[model samples]
Target: MFPASKQAIGMDLPAGMTLLLTLGVSGLILYLSIRTSWIWRHLPPGPTPLPLLGNIMEIGRSDVANSLKKFSDKYGEVFTIYLGSRPVVVVTGYKQVKEVYLDKADDFLGRGDLPAWNNFYKSQGVIFTDVLEWWRELRGFSISSLRDLGFGKSGTEDGIQEEAHCLVEELKKTKESFIDPQLCLRKAVCNINLSTMFGNRHEYEDKDLVVVLSCIQNTFAAANSSWVQEKANPNSVFTRSHLLSSALQIFFAGVETTSTTLYYSLLILLKYPDICAKFQKEIDHVIGPNRCSTIKDKSSMPYTEALIHEIHRFIDLLPLGVPRKTVREVTLKGYKIPQGINILPLLSSVLKDPTCFKYPAEFNPENFLNEKGEFQKNGAYMPFAAGKRNCLGEPMARMMLFLFLTTIFQNFDLKSSVPFEELDITPLVSGFGNLPRNYKCAFITR
Candidate 1:
């Protein structure tokens, strides 16, 4: 056996190793703390973030829009928030957002790499791609092609009218029974894009169409598996992957937003019958029941026009807007945001800015109306975002909303199956998009 002192030394060796390990970890944490502070010092002011996780714990999982708004209240109109190790600078309020998105458009034109979008499409399409030349070419082609095909022009109105008729026919089958109109509205909206893109519209029960819809739906739901296979030639600027990705982009943005907006509009009408009455009265006087509603009738129906604008504002879809990045190191609103920093232009803040509207929170059409009771426009209205990267599908979406809502309400008297008070207009999901909760309603013929 060894002496007592020698044995004690052997035991103390393991304890010494443990102490060194602890100190190493402590030193690392201290270093990271210093490094993070140094980096943040050059950027805009924001809440203190923890190492590695950044502000994820503070942002939480639900209602990120509101969470960012809370941070904005404390941090001012222009502030920074970290996503993991990445820093995102959020610009709130109308003036600041306008300054960044409008005045300094080119500086903030880069599309920040979003993990979800990168995994799905790998930045191949117009929406998520950072290739400036590709975006220009694609956007130019899309606008021209869509215009040629009568997207925002008068030529496409017939197609919209046809789809509107189909929707009315589908609702008629519900025959006083309570039916969730979400799927039908989705099919109608998807078919419009399908017809526009492929010159073919799928039936509501078509299997192939269902699979395509499922893929588009999964994209928003954050399903990561490869949805569309690449099919373009290697030599072309618009590769097979680019084509597939662009088509998917168009389908996802085209279908979801227009359908969700229509659904919300109907839900709002169901909740407030008085508003519906005024809307129907306007529709009756302007379009009449003899023929389908046209875009030309929009000007004559001030109430209807106001209601549509109000819906766009109140719904506040894409609340955070798409994350954009600074192409180069730029100073915005006295803050030095470094190059490649993600920018979240808080669109919801602009839509709901109290200074811009009389009652921002309440769903009031008067918000879009002047003192003369005529439909008016607000500069703060930016549901499709603003700038060079504003939504490519805005014109199509506007036409679709006007035609579909007017057509449906013109044909049928909408009534909720449940009590109006019990109906939940709150979105079921509130992350990238504001998706309204599913509700049923009846469509009785006028």
Candidate 2:
């Protein structure tokens, strides 16, 4: 009788445990559903989010750009999307982007939530800081100091010209053999910033230069800039940590974007040899091969300028510009967005908007050219993004693109074994950058 009773008890315990486990899961699902609904109750309508998971599945891991486009099409220009339970207000189209970023710039000056960057930077850098005053001081100091040193001006042209000459010499070593240009171009572009910041540039083979390049790729860069060290203000935001972070921001953001653009420009030119020939023609007529290219020459070479602008538009390097957060509650397009909600300015939509460009989807330099073949500015052209918080490196990047490209073409002609039709120019979209696919091409001396 005792043995039978023990068996009965064991059987009942197992049944009870199974029922309890089922109820616990169901209760958790209910709680999450209610919480998610309450969180996004007043936000703009968007794709339904699942409990715990949010809309990550719908957003898809790799197709975030396309997902945002699809959501905007269904929910209108201003819509909401969940990135792992965090609601991001995605603003698309030029009209809506301009309104949110430009019209309400002050209200949305707060840095948006970026979990990865936030964790690493700990809100120390200018790019990721939510402390508005600190960001202003650093930004002001950086711009003024860099400008004084000739960044984005003729002051830096001699350095760039020297580096471009080195690049041509390096490519000349390839002896017209197909070689990867990524390393050579990256080093050359990075040297421009290094020379400005450190007052010296490294030889391409220098061990320290390799280390610095590695650091830049891994969310860090050297910060021995004289400006940062010269101004000692222990009480101010110019602490060692903050200054180092800012320098890292400049190198990482500036070098990667500029080099990738130059790489894409080469790829695009390789794909369109006729355009390449035209660039050479313009370079010959305006600057000529004997002299180094300068910022002033940009005015005389409309075709070259137009092509570079088209590259920026065509590549859409950063489809979604750095996210911004609402500093205060603001009403936009009849939607009442609460303060602190993350905002994603869909730059790709604006860059590719049908109304903005005649050939927005294709690589056509005519987008920035008139019937007279002179470069013309388009209001929709916001490749570096629009508003006050747009890329601080814009001037430097523009200068580099013009100088590096003109110098390269002036010295060497692009030769690729890949047939024009077979050559793929589509950008390989990474997390935040649209990278050109790896290919080998020869640089024959012109």
Candidate 3:
């Protein structure tokens, strides 16, 4: 008998091709099996992943948070989940998340793999880039530049107040007719960011501003006119690509979260008229009807403060948050995580951690309110996330949420045609953002 190799080569063309294909497929299967086993061997325990698919089917498409919560329940808080072949360690609950962000911050400073952004950003800009030094410099530069442009200051409050006035005027145009507030809210928020970036505000109907709102190319073009004028040093970290990326990151990040939070706050308030009444009562007593709301008034308005905080915690926007990665080999909760491993510190887990909030599953402002009705800060309140990579725009976002919402409530009563029982406060899309369901409401002048 011929040797096995000789016999395979000696076969008819069809037989030989068939043999070769079978052998190749068998080899691939063997390789993948070994590689998969090896990968899981070193990482923390998790649901068994199939080759190539890697726990993706397990995760499903919608309801990623609920799926991860199930894994956290079965495998414990610090467990791994694979997105395709990539193994991302899912750190849930306050204990594990705090440790990853606060305790082992230096080790996990690198941003995690976000395939959607990584394909485009490619390790550039402050948001998606993995370079720690680059992030540090860019973050510092951005904060300083924004400070110069009046971010998180009295000047910013004035700008927001002006924008809020414009928003009220626009809503007044609706003449108490039911209008979807999403576009108007987004535009208002976008203008505030534009003012910070360009040093001037635009008319709501300005052709350039409208184009910028509708087209991303014009958005970058607008950004280009402002940032490219900055003086550069020979070894400056602010390269053209970095500047553009930073500009894009700032514009999107600045608008989306704050605007979405405001949108959700409105829906939640509309859902509960009693809560909305109390919130407006607090605003009326503190800020009054004649004057615009300011940041200083935030301190004296505990119920208002508590309501804002509750909105953040209840909606749980950015449930998973931006992923993080390990800069070096580190052990978390006794499990060894290798360098460059992606981590998802579940912000939803912390925001709704049972031990931290009294009504973790409900939308009660009492979660942030103490016995005296004073607004109390909860350590688990991490809508802005925690650690070294916490949101740079937290202060600005807080101010916007306070000023814009207060201004709206102070000026008009939010009325929706949808009955209170019928209003759906559950997130319409829960994957990346916990957004509210779309509905029309009239902003009646109060």
Q: Pick the candidate with the highest lDDT.
A: 3
Number of backbone collisions per candidate, in order? 1, 0, 0
Give the number of colliding residue pairs in candidate 2: 0
How do the residues 332-389 of candidate 1 rate in per-residue lDDT, one tens digit apiece? 8898888888999999999999999999998889998888889998999999998889
Off by over 4 Å in 2: 1-13, 217-235
Cα-lDDT of candidate 1: 0.84
The RMSD of every model to the true structure, in order and in angstroms, is 5.1, 4.0, 4.8
Better of 1 and 3 by lDDT: 3
Q: Against the true structure, whose TM-score is highest?
A: 3
Q: What's the lDDT for residue 267 in model 2? A: 89
- The alpha-carbon deviation from the true structure for residue 28 of candidate 2, after best TM-score superposition, in angstroms, is 2.8
Give the local distance difference test score of model 2.
Answer: 0.84
Candidate 2: residue 173 lDDT (0-100): 90
TM-score of candidate 3 to 2 decimals: 0.93
The residue-level lDDT of candidate 2 at 345 comes to 89
